[model samples]
Target: MTPKAKAATGALTLASAAILGAMHLWEGQRLTVYADKLAGGLPTYCSGRTQPPRPVGSTLTQAECDAIDRQTATEYGRAILACIPAERMDQNSFDAMTLFAINVGKTAACNSRAAHLMRDGQRENACRALAYGPDGRPVWSYARGVYVQGLQNRRRYEMNWCLKLATAA
Candidate 1:
C-alpha cells in the first residue's frame, strides 16, 4: 500500500488491509477516465470515483489515482462508521460491508437490509443479506434492471468473505 493508502485506512475503525484489498480487487484501477455502462455511462476514473467529474479523455498518474482512491475510501469509511457499529463487527464482515458500500453507494448500503440487520444485532443474517433478501431471492445482482453475472459473482464473493468462507477463484 502507498502512504496515501495507509493514511486513508488509518481514519477507519474497520480492518484496513482487508478493506483496501477488496476495493482493489473489485474496483480495479483506471487512470484514464472512461464511461461506466453499469453506472449509466457516467464518466469515472481512479478506482470508480464519479464526483468532480473529469472529462472522458482525462488521465491521471498512478500516484494521483492512488490519492483519489484514498480520499474516496476515507469518505466512504466515515459514512460506514456513522451507521454501523464497526467496533463490534468482525474484521471480515466489516470489510465485506465496506466493499459493498463502495459498489452500491454509501446511503444505499447504509439503508440496506444488511445494515438494518447489523444494527439489530443479527450479524450472520446481515452478511447473508448482501446477496439475498427476505424472499430468499438475489439482491444487488442486477444492472439496469437486468440480472448480471458479474454482479452476482461480486455479491457471492462479498457474502463468502463476510462469512469467512473460502472464496471462489
Candidate 2:
C-alpha cells in the first residue's frame, strides 16, 4: 500500500479500537441479551456464533460474558475494516462505521448506503444515512412508539459522533 493508504488504515484501526472501547463503556457486557437473528426473523439469544449467544437454558459467569463480548466485538471490528478494503477513512467515519458494523452485521455494513456514500466521498451524506433504518426510513421504534425507543436513537448518536464529536484523542 502507498504511505497515505497505510496511514489511513492505521488511523481506521485505531479509531475502531476506540469505538469498541466506548461501546463496552456504554453497553456493558450483557450475559444474556436477545439479539435479532442475522438472517432476519425474531430476536433470540442465539443469533450466530460470532456473538456470545446464550444457549437455551444456559448460564454464564460475568468473566465469561465479558471475554465473549470482547472477542465478538473485536471480530466484528476487524470485519468492518476488511469490508472497506481500499477506502480511505477519517477518524469519525471509522468510529461510526465500526460501531455500526458491531450493531448490524458485516454484510449490512458493507452494503449500506452509508458505506457507499463514504466510498463515493460523500461523507456528510453517509453520516446522515446512519440514521436510516433497514427499510430506509428514519424512525424506527422497538415498541409501538411508547414504553420503548429503538435503534434510531443509537443511529442518531452515531451520526452525531461521526459528523461532530468523534476525534483522534
Candidate 3:
C-alpha cells in the first residue's frame, strides 16, 4: 500500500475501538439469535449482526460477540474510508461515521449527502448531514415507514460526535 493508504489504515484501526464501543452501547448485546421484525424478520444476533445466519435459538459467547463486532466494524470502516478521504476525518468524526455506516449500511452511508460534503471538503456540513438531509428533516430516522425515536437519538449522537472537531475546521 502507498504511504497515504497505510496512514489511513492506521487511523481507521485507532478509530475502530471507539466505533466498537459506540456500537456495543447502541446495538446492545444479544447472546441468542432473534428475528428482527423491523428488518423483515432477519435473523440477528451479536451486536445486530445478521450475516452467517443462525437459527433463532442460536447462542454465542461474549468473546464471540466481541470478535464479530470488531471484524464487522473494521470491514465497515475500510469500506467507508475507501470513499471518503481518511485524511479529512478526525477520530471522533471517523468513529461516528463508522457507527452510522454500520447501522445504515456501507452503500447508503458512502452515497449519503454527508459523504458528498466530506468529499467536497465541507467537513462540518458533512457531519450535519448525518442528522438532517437536504430538506432539513431527519434522515434515516424511520423503520418500516414509522418514525423511531431510537434512530433519531442515534443520529443525534453521531452528529454530535461528528461535529466535535468542527470548531477547528
Candidate 4:
C-alpha cells in the first residue's frame, strides 16, 4: 500500500461519518430513538468522549454536523497516532480500527485486542478482533443501560473491510 493508504487519515474521517449514519445519527444532531422507544442524544460533532454534548432540543444543522465530525475525527486520529505506530498497519486495518476507536472511545480502543494485534504485526487478527467481544465472545455493547446491536454490526462491517486488505509484508 502507498503511504497515503497506510496513513488512512481521510478514510478514518469518512468512516466516522459512515458509522454515525448507520446509527441513524446522520440527520444532523438529534436523539437516537430506537425501535423500542429508547432515546439518547448523539451529537454529530462529539465534544464529549462518549457522545456529543446535548444540543438545544438535541439538534444541529448539516454544516454544524460536518464541522463537528471533522474535529472529532482529528481528535481521535491524534489519539490513535499516539499509541499505534502509523506504519505498522495497512490503510484498511488502520481505518477500521480508527472508526472503532471513535465509537468505543480512544482509551478503550487503544487498549483493545485490535490495538494489541496491530502492535504485534498481526494485522489480520487485528481486523478480526473488531468482530469479537473484549473476551472473544459474541459481539455486544451496552448503551443507556441497555444492550445495542448496532455496535456489533458496525464492528463486523469494519472487520470485513480490514480483512479484505490482505496480509502485509
Give the runs in model 3 whose Cα sits over 4 Å from its true position.
1-10, 166-169
**Model 1: how far residue 31 lies from native, Å:** 0.3
Instruction: Give the TM-scores of the predictions, in the order they appear.
Output: 0.86, 0.67, 0.90, 0.66
Task: Give the root-mean-square deviation of each candidate in angstroms.
Answer: 4.7, 5.5, 3.1, 5.8
Give the clashing residue pairs of candidate 4, or none: none
Task: Give the local distance difference test score of model 1.
Answer: 0.80
Model 3, 6-111: lDDT tens digits are 6757554533567877988999888999998778899999888988899998899999998888878878888888888888887788888888898999999999
Between candidates 2 and 4, which one is better according to TM-score?
A: 2
Clash totals in order: 0, 0, 0, 0
lDDT of each: 0.80, 0.61, 0.85, 0.60
lDDT of 3 at 64: 96
Candidate maximizing TM-score? 3
Candidate 1 regions with alpha-carbon error over 4 angstroms: 1-15, 165-169
Candidate 3 has an lDDT of 0.85
lDDT per residue for candidate 4 within 90-130, as digits (tens), equals 65666666667767778998998788888888888788888
- Candidate with top lDDT is 3
TM-score of 1: 0.86
* Cα RMSD of predicted structure 4: 5.8
**lDDT for predicted candidate 4 compared with the true structure:** 0.60
Number of colliding residue pairs in model 3: 0
